[model samples]
Target: MLTTLLYSPQDNSLIQGDDSHIAQWQQSDDAILWLNIDGELTEPLQAMLKQTFNLHQLALQDASRDRHPPKIEDFGDHTFILLRGLSADSESINCDNILLAMFISERFIITRHSARSLSIERTMAALHAGDISLATGTGALSLKISRFVVKRYHKILFDLETRLEQLESVMLTTADDKVLAEVVLYKTDLTRLRRNFHYHVELFNNLRDEPSLPFDSALAHEINDVCEHQHRAASLADLFYQVASDLIDGYISISAHRLNNIMKVLTIITAIFVPLTFIAGIYGMNFEYIPELKNPYGYFIVWGVMLCITAVLIWLFRRRKWI
Candidate 1:
């Protein structure tokens, strides 16, 4: 689907239309157009992008890909940026990512994504609600959308931190396989997030340090702010990954300690029973020359001896605090 929003600041009017309005929007020099392409990029849409925006063929190819790392490129006339955004229908922890490919120039910004994007939706809402003014130029509007994307990472990181804390508490009270599995999953997810955020950090840093077009100092500051946010998101992801690792390690240590205690108890029981078993073995011998077996009170004596032995072993264990 193609949705276009054209804002003409001179007349102070907003026009919402489809692909047909592109030619009309392009005729006005002061009009700022935002073209949003959702889902797969069809041939006609691709053709429109190539013809209308004069986007590079390579950039269009990268934009059409299902998976691409977050990056920024300068094509002299326009800036091409590929960012990772969260899918609208997924949870924060186990959410899927959608690529938000943008071709931004002075007067227009084109965004393409394979799936619905929360960041794009929020930005469009802001534009419609008059919270974000298109008169600010496409660069600032793109930054606003990038900021929204970074905010999603912040939310995910917060959820991850909360879940890790809960897992820590659960580890203390119980040793469940499910919790371990979940921690591993979180670790894996955080690893991926950290890598992606790292790329985003680089992308924003590059955009800030060397922009495609010479932006004013105010726009440069906004880029710096977004870069800092990306850094924080990446750092948080790395930290949470370590937390997940520690939880797994702690769980293993707890399980080992429990196993060791059980083994120690079994060892102690065996130590106490070994000698008793020896005496019983000797008394059960069928040799006719056994003198103790001839005694009338032999069975009672054996019982008393066994009880005394048991008492001694119990006292010894108590003194050593092995229990």
Candidate 2:
């Protein structure tokens, strides 16, 4: 789907249309154009991007792909940026689910994404509500959209931290297979998020240090703020990954300790029964006649002997603190 929003600062009017309005928007000098493309890049849409916007072929190719790492490239007249956006329906921290490709220039900004992007939706909503004024400049507009994109990570990271705390608490008493599985899943998710956030940190840092277009002081400040946000997000992801690792190690240690306690109890029981089993074995042998069979009190004597032996073993084990 293709959607266009043209905002004219002079008249404070907004025009919402499709691809057909592109020509008219291009003719106006006092308007800021925001073109959003969702889903696959069909041949006709690709042609229009090349002919109408004059986007670089290489940049278009990268945008057309299903997956690409976050990056920024300065093309003399415009800047091409590939950013990973969180999918609206994503349940985990998988950054590959949505890729947003942007071409930003002085007059217009174009965004392409393979999936429904919450960041794009939020920005569009803000634009329609008059909360965001593109009259500032397309550079500021791009930064606004980027800011929305980065905001999506905040809730996800907070939820992840909450889950880690819960799991840690649960692990204190029990480390079952299910709990272990969850820990593993979280670890994997955090790893992916860490890598994604790391790329974003680098991308924004590059944009801040060496911008493709000249940004005024305000825009430059905004870029710096976004870079700091990216850096903070990356650090949190790394920290969470480490926490997940520690959880796994703790689970292993707890499991081992439980098994050792079980084995120790079994060993103590076996030790206490060994002598009794030996005495019983001796009497059970049907030789011409065991001497004990000739006496009536032999059975009671055997019982007393076995009980005494058990008591001694128990006392010895307790004295050694082995039970």
Candidate 3:
């Protein structure tokens, strides 16, 4: 869908317009126009962008690409910005990042995104409600939208931290394979989150050097705020990933130590039975000339010997603290 909100700085009035008179509206310099294009960039839409906004071909091409990280391109007449907005999936571990493309010029701002965004909706609602307190200049509007996107990141980071804490709690109660799998899954998510926010840091830094936007000082300050936010989010992600990894390792080490103790106990039991088994085997051997076969008390003597051997083994094991 294509949505447009035009704000006249002179009268402080806001009005929504259709695509039919967009080109005519662009001819006016008295108002700041915000054109938001959502969904795929069809050929006709691309043509409209070219004819109405005079956007460069390369910039349009970059915007149309299916996948691109956050970046900025200075096209002399205007500047194009590509940003990532995170959308968390509560039902599952996997999350998504929506790509937002924007063009900022002297009198107009164009925003394009493949998916619905909270920032866009909020800004539109504010504009429709005639909230002119926000500066309608292209630079300020872009900064506002960027700030909203960063706010979303803050929520995602908080969720990540909460998940890690919960996982750690569960891990302490049970050190099992299922818990380990969850730890690894959360680690993967943290890694991806860090990568996504890292790219935003670079994009915001580039925005700071942007020469096309108006009000350099204000724009730079806003960009710096975004940079700081991205840095904080990325750092949190890194810390969470490391914590998850350490938890997994600790659980595995505990499991290994438990198994080793079990094996040691079994080994001690087998050692105590070896000599007893040998004595039984000798008495059971079929030999006609065996001297014990002619003796009446041979059975009692062998029984006493076997008992002694068992008692000696037990005493030795106890003394050595191997039981």
CA lDDT of each prediction against the hidden true structure: 0.89, 0.85, 0.78
Best-to-worst order by TM-score is 1, 2, 3
> Which runs in model 3 stand beyond 4 Å of their true positions?
88-93, 129-136, 209-212, 289-323
Which runs in model 2 stand beyond 4 Å of their true positions?
91-96, 214-216, 292-296
Candidate 1: give the clashing pairs. Answer: none
* Highest-lDDT candidate: 1
**Candidate 2 lDDT, tens digit per residue, 251-323?**
9999999999999999988988899999999998879978888899999999999999999999998999987
Error of 3 at 256 (Å): 1.7
For candidate 1, lDDT tens digit of each residue in 1-323? 88999989987777888977798887887788889999898777788788888988889989999998988999888899999988898667787999999989888899999998989989999988989888888899999999999898898789878888988999988989999999999988888888899999999888877878524566988888899899999899889999999999999999999999999999999999998999999988888799888899999999999999989998999999998
User: What CA RMSD would candidate 1 show?
Assistant: 1.7
RMSD to native, candidate 2? 2.1
The TM-score, computed over Cα atoms with residue i paired to residue i, of candidate 2 is 0.92
Best by TM-score: 1
Cα displacement (Å) at residue 106, model 1: 0.7
- Between candidates 2 and 3, the one scoring higher on TM-score is 2
